[model samples]
Target: MCTACLIENVKSHMLSRRSLFSGAAATAAMGVAAGALSARPVLAQAKGRVVDLTHAYDSDFPTFDGKPGILYEVDKNFDPDGYHLFKLTIFEHTGTHIDAPLHFAEGGTSVDALPVENLIAPLCIVDISARAAEDPNAVVEPADIEAWVSANGEIPAGACVAMNSGWTARIGNPAWRNLPDGTLAFPGFSKAATDLLAQTGAASIGVDTLSLDPGNSPDFAVHYSWLPSGRFGIEGLANLEQLPASGATIFIGAPKHRGGTGGPARILAMH
Candidate 1:
């Protein structure tokens, strides 16, 4: 063959090889794209999440009467073009709030001072709803804690132990406030239970009720024991019946109010 013809033939062969390799590359790319598309349904189906609790907050929602009022009003004319915006004013410890260490301790940590890691932790939910229903002033004692641990492994350190007293059912009723004697009476932890949890390195204590101690008692021994230990408190929580006894991870977020001893928080749980 002539020199020019030979060079043209070589060029044609190189082009054909390049085309073949390009086709193989495109095929591999399509396979990867198909694999990714196939995994989409699996990822979508695996996303199983639910709310284990709900928080109650409103004027009609019953709270301690003598405490500050939770007020909110529309700022009708304030925004440009008359775009109405709501304004809220209330005490930090208004509804579903966290009681930081400083709530009772003189020099202890406040809401702003609490460690970030302590806000979220494992939850050990104790169910005493039946007992609480029998006696309005029921208190969870150390033996109860031991019983719970025996049934569901150990109560891990750095976990929030929530006492479920079924008191949330009475929240909207006329008898939601203090009992007949004029003193609030509900369910909570006893001194022994509180101290045991504090010593065991519980990150915080939570309850689906108004107080960490039985309402009728003037002495808040449970609160006194837990708060002074620098652990946090989660009160006024609702829907404790939805969670399992010992497998949920709780997430707690309090509003960043400066120098606040306590502040309203949004608490959620995940299994």
Candidate 2:
């Protein structure tokens, strides 16, 4: 099925569940009005706690293949111009960002075309940090997804699966890229794992590393396997260690660039 169809199916299922809950609430309210039960105490709504999952972009931020990182210039300063204004020159894919399907898939959805619902969804973290520590080239495999399912049920449809390989801890260091041998060596998703997640109806797959595919991959098979389905990718994420394996909802605030293959984003997780 096309990406639009997959998203529509997910929306349909969510609406049905919401309707069921709304109906039950309405019945309870009626019972209360009729005095069938004692008056219940009104509970206050809980405030959501949000965690930043994006890295702050700066000149020091790492980039792939020695690409220019970030450039900031003061166009106007308060002392001289009565306004503190600046111009930022940044690559769309710099720092923490969203990789629209068009980044890898020809004729796929651009960053601006992604639906709002798809930008916010249940967050799932698959941690391969221990393994990554042992081998910088370790990849998250299909068996890892199966293990996650075995322990915590199936991943919900339209969820964003983030691979936490603990690489975020090395963000500013040379280890983030690991190019000693002229090949990047950080951990990422294998093609099998990407295929499994796509099959499970994942809306997006993310990583704390620079790319969703491992550093040494020349074909970027994992990106091809997922993005062509109209899904997205998030990379260079920070603070994955602060989030739980499940239950958090992610809000991806990506720049709306028309015809953009990808763009920077402010990713947040609310629990």
Candidate 3:
């Protein structure tokens, strides 16, 4: 065979493999949504790379009400009790946490009642960082979702559509959860965007801020609509910058307390 022909054949074979991989990736991305949670689906995460999306929190972590999210009391000291154990007082919805449907919907699914399949599924990151940088109250609008789909293909069903507004960079700053004048200010999911997500059968939404709605939101529109539909939300997520827009699987280590709205979660994404 001619050298040129050989080179062309190799290139064609590589392209074919690339296309096949992309198609299969999209299929497995929504595997859990179809109730396919076998070992094959478990291995759907590509490259075997994992990223921790949870942020460590303490009493000082930012909150929506400007109050500490947790308090600690030393119940036992090593000097006296042979081992130290601190009795902790923690508030649901603090730190990197999941917000169950009950957070907004009456008689909705509680944190412990969320489906296991929904807790582990495709991870889709929609970035609005540039806009969030300029407007603290920026949100993941429908337009943003459209653009993401245009570039990265469709959002898979049962996916966790996370808004990466670059707010993770402001973790310790006053502007992270509030403006200078004591008003809340942070980026979140706009109602229109969540509407699109719901239409696509998305299981959950996430934000790097304290709430699912933008800080200045008057009605919590996204929360009211999205949660009542039986979907969940995650807030105060960190390290979203380390993940990609698609092809990652999220595992939400949700709180198991019965009747709880939600609590701090340890979330991880494997790509």
RMSD of 3: 12.5
For all candidates in order, the CA lDDT equals 0.78, 0.86, 0.89
lDDT of 2 by residue, 139-215 (tens): 99999999888887788888899999999889778889876766788889999898889889889989999889988
Candidate 2 error regions (>4 Å): 1-47
In candidate 1 the C-alpha lDDT for residue 26 amounts to 99
Clashes of each: 1, 0, 1
RMSD of candidates 1 onward, in order: 8.4, 14.2, 12.5
lDDT, candidate 1, 84-149, per-residue tens = 677888766656889988899999888998887677677788888999888888888898899998
Task: Please identify which of the two predictions, 2 or 3, would achieve the higher lDDT against the true structure.
Answer: 3
Taking all chains together, each candidate's TM-score versus the true structure is: 0.78, 0.82, 0.85
Provide the lDDT at 207 for model 3. 92
State the TM-score for model 2. 0.82
Instruction: lDDT for model 2, please.
Output: 0.86
lDDT of 3: 0.89
